[model samples]
Target: MRRLATALLGLTLALPLQAEWVFADFEAVSGTPQAKLFPHLESAGRGNLAAGGGQLALVWEDNRDGSPQVYAALRDLGRTGFSAPRRLSTGAEAYEPVVLGLGEGRFLAAFEQDGKVVMRVFSAAAQGPLATLDAAASAQPTLAAGKVGLHAVWGRRDGRFLRLVSAPLTVDGLKPHAGAARAVDTSPAQDEQLYASLVATAGGYALAWEDRRAGHTRLLTATSSDGRKWSEPQPLNEIPRSGTARELGLGRGPGVTRVCLAGDGADTVAAVWMDKRDFLSGYDIYAGVSTDGGAGFGANEKAQDVFGAEKPQWHPAVAVTPHGVVAAWDDPRDDSPDIWLAARAGGKDWSDDFTLDGARGTGSQDNPALLWHGGRLHLAWVHRDEQGGQVRYAQARWE
Candidate 1:
């Protein structure tokens, strides 16, 4: 028998569900709503997308030996698929590309170029660059703009400690003042570690990263309104099973470190990450939710088991949609990492799990990126092959 929760008026109904988890759709994406310019090749780094009016803006990198270019795939949701991939980089090199759709008719894309955060805005037509922003020591760049102007944040790796810094930019690259970048958190042993996942929240934005401090590997979080100033770093999730406070032995990397912050505004933020306790289990996916804004959070709960035995899951990529919080990750239970998905109606406990098509073998399905739009879940990932790989996508519906 399976236990599940119900969805009611944006609250939990506490109902039991069916025994088995089944998927509704398993078909790959049809066509490209837009088209690509250069010879198409699979991605080497991360591929991310944002949702908008009957469309989506996909951003990825081609970090090859020749030229490293940033590309966008726009799906118009008509009789067409994604038309083609468009190259967005103009010069030198662009890495860690992040894009945000600023409602109305504005699009913001930020990336690292020449060791600086370079921001470019378009008129929503994908015509050309309307303005340029040059930020200092910017990497892992993320951008979001509103009536208050454009906001961007990145990791600053200077000196012994790696710090997270953010700055605000003018609509036309002219700020009334040069905002300062505050060190939200620091690396104590001069270890080269950084926090990567960042997104704009309601009142502000929330970021999650893996850090090694206090003699243990822990997940840390920080929030901010202006991106220049941030809240104190707090441990987002934990399970109590320790020997002693003085000599707690935490595992090494590839642990439950990466996270995704998703919710309605910044009010209901969900922190999803991977964890493995010393008790009796494998890797598990866990999440912590903040319903009353970023003030307080709920208890960290297990989301799924990688081995289908209620434990040992790894490599999760998550997204928040109107339907609920959608999480897609690779499951390495049977020596192979297959794409698995879970959904909650409006962030409640999910009814069941869904496996995806086009993900096969024991090599590497890796990160399964998810998007919920058009009343369906759009999932994409790097499907590994002997020669190389291809970016695959699928759409699934929830009842």
Candidate 2:
């Protein structure tokens, strides 16, 4: 799970003359007549963000009615506030609802409830009925809208083993293609946990996940040109295991990797993970980038500029557009988790680290989700207090 943050507040960070960063006041989006408190009764920051056609959509889990349920809110192109959250699931418990921009004015949302996957199609003004994609055991549902269509993937438990399954859908209604739901990985060992991620590309999509089939977690990726068929599973991280660490003996050991592909006609893809190669400073944010779509990747490098800090830094989230790529994560260098962001524009080096939501000495901030929408940077995260959790959002413009 992404680490927790605390207490909502306003913050601003000055960038170099090349780029000016200004943040709007952080606003609360959860809780309601249904919730007992000002913020939601209980909320989390693992929510997802999507933007299209001058509208932004956010989805997350909210425990407003005495049970965990999936809820969503919408914001118009120039608005600073979000509409009231509308419940999307009827189950008593729903987890990790993810949303994707389906072009025009359509959006797709999916989540896991009672070990099954439930989906819905909605716009800013209207929504469709709940559609149960699968009734069996499933976890970590993810969706991506590409040039071909929308693609969905999840981890399905088959007795003792976990397999990866995917389906292709049309944009308007998310109608699954004929013979679409199929297993992507050819084989895997028993009890290998899997969480899949999908990213949109020019003609198709790219999928990535970490599997323990080889007795250690390795980042794996596959490409598809039409969403129905995928290339063979391939390893993106080629670093040899280093025995310096207790987990691995020779190469880099990746745990819980997250992936994102660039948009706005850019064909770059990046994978960020915590690697135990150094063995002394704890896990670091290492990334692998592919320049030519997902055909291949270059060497892995430390994505963040953690120059002198020795504390654990993880749970990296990235957003990419034609302008640049931005990565943010929770860092403990200040004795408490503070959201930090680093950016790289064009082929230039990454900018020095800058503190986002700087609530130092007051509360901790973590689990940041980034979205490059309408030429601005929109960030959503969870803020926690002695009272409860609150889902808050802020926006930044690069001038």
Candidate 3:
């Protein structure tokens, strides 16, 4: 693989953790975005990437207008791909779009419109309108920032009370008077499901999900320094009989549950999912950690060495750097979903399987993406063999 990372970054630290699973190095582009893409175009993961300096923004879920829409693309660095995608939103059916880089240039994405879950703080560079926030029937919505402003939470189907509230909006979306919607998880039981994931480190925003009261289907968490003051829904998956779950579908992005408050913050947090023994059916790519961040969480660790559960990994796109957590998915073993990668660096060890190839010609690779950039790890997805799928990129740099 081109001598892989210049002799593995000058070789040192003893690295070791490679249990024979090398598939590193990948390239595949065609995520088109100059407009003019219609054939039932499908791009999920509403939007979940930030990475700075070297560049990388890339959001998703743009069904070419028939329904879902929301786009963004930047991928800079040595440059070789992505930078054309730009449609902010048109709306008809937008799913997840949780982003947050608000250091200065500002960012905060958030999604689910039509079904509810909204929030859009704005400023990848800015131009005009933006700063929307919503709440009604809410769906997988999560936004963070505490101490004073911004911080939202969602998943509130009302009537039957499938709880999870929290509020405080206003970067433009308006609706932050302070303290109101707060209901961790009442558990009326039933199918009473939930699928949240929010992270913000320090002392704010730390939510994870997948619940069904107890009948089976676990993994829950909650914490809020501000989003509107929340904290009281714990259940970070302890395994055991491991909730007879199912429905691990992660395809189409916007984050299919891969929260991260990251480490060293005092509660160390990390989460990933797609593990479905049956919550609905087949799924793979499980992970869980929370050294204390959410207070407790640890189990469901099964990246399956590389993939399985019938092979067809989807959704998954995580990032946490210092060289510790980097995930990417969308690998159909070979039927074409290729764009897999796994890294861990120190939380014990991992990294020795990478595959994201395509460009000379592009087609189905679906929405597999990963971003770290503060240390470099960029990889993109959606490369439909050509004239069909578009969106691709590749990058690696960790010494």
Candidate 4:
């Protein structure tokens, strides 16, 4: 029996060796910080990196000029490095920048300026502000580009309750659709919704967010054939059924939070989030899949293999690749948080978690943004040392 156990362990260790990720050395995406302070990257659930049309784009907030401003960097796909960071915000305090690739070397960036959401378009030659959304009391804005138009969603505070609002934009001119900005979720005013993630799916868009309507935080999703109309929100996390022995009441189980969604530009969509399901353990990473364009999701599955009393995982980012779905998150199993990733191939279960090469260090690494394009996985995250934080970038190709 001892020999059999040893053989099984060896097989498990050897299984994923052939297809491991070959990662490049991490480089600073924010360039040399002019100030000694940390450059702020967008929050975990929001996108900060995009790749399309042979170009890669990254956006963040910096205070090198004495005030918070939005900045961006572009890199050619065939090149090995990114351009020097360029300021995108004209004035006012700005942060939480999200970027979406518009194909043909064009990109769209949105950030919160002062209190409103400001958007700009970028190309190889020029960049300019596209529009300013009227969401003055909003947070965590996300963007998704589809065949028909661009979709934007954010959490807007209405009096005591927080609502989820969506706005549609024309693809050609990137202008807001007339009267298209409206609340999409039907959660009651007493309940709060936040941390929205939007992804373009086949013939439409899918939106997901963290909800507190069940008396505990949970993840819910909605689908739309057109940007203007949305389907009813559905829960992505599964709750235990009552009436059995040792059953708990509704909303009494572990809660879900900080969800990020990725689609394969078709029917396959994946959602990854931080979950607190184990009473003795800290937060764990959980994921769900939808094959019918987010109209429904399968049972939730654990994405990480490690769980301990105080080791928590956070800021999960997911992407759908030709091989399968891959999820990445910052984990503290090594004292300081480092980026870890897992892959699910075809119909198989998730593979064992592996740390990204060059991501494990003394400092903290968090808020991973993943983009799978041109047969490579591009990743960007915030790295913090004693001095300050800097946005770091690295890419990996499957062996």
Which predicted model would earn the best TM-score? 4
Question: Could you arrange the candidates by lDDT from highest to lowest?
Answer: 4, 2, 1, 3
TM-score ranking from best candidate downward: 4, 2, 1, 3
Clashes of each: 22, 10, 41, 0
User: Per-residue lDDT for 1-399 in model 1, tens only?
Assistant: 122333232244543443322233332232221122122222211226566656666666664325666666666644336645566677777666766665544456666666666656543365455233445454665554433455665667666655566677555422122245656553343443354566566667676766665445677777777666677777776745554232344443324556666555546666677776533455667777776545456677666633354435666666666656767666655466667666655444653445644564545565666555556556676555454544556565554
Query: What TM-score does model 2 achieve against the real structure?
Result: 0.86
List all candidate RMSDs to the true structure. 7.0, 5.1, 18.7, 5.0
lDDT of each: 0.56, 0.67, 0.54, 0.77
| TM-scores, each model vs. reference | 0.75, 0.86, 0.31, 0.88
lDDT of 3 at 144: 54
Question: In model 3, which regions exceed 4 Å deviation?
Answer: 1-65, 69-91, 97-111, 115-229, 232-289, 296-326, 329-340, 345-353, 356-381, 390-399
Badly placed stretches (over 4 Å) of model 4 are: 1-17, 33-35, 171-179, 186-188, 240-253, 307-310
**TM-score for candidate 3:** 0.31
Residue 383 displacement in candidate 4 (angstroms): 1.2
User: For residues 144-216, what per-residue lDDT tens digits would candidate 2 score against the true structure?
Assistant: 7766766788777778866778887654364433235778765644545466767777757777777777767
Clashes of 2: 10
Q: Which tens-of-lDDT digit does each residue in 1-399 have in candidate 3? A: 322210122232333544322223553332443344532212222235665445556566656656766666555555555555566665667765666555544565666777766555455455335433545676766555544556666677767745666666555332223346666654454555465666666766677766655554566677766555566677664443434433233321212333333333335666666654433335666666666566666555655453334564666756666647766666555455556666676554555545533521234565555555454655566665435545655666664
Best by lDDT: 4
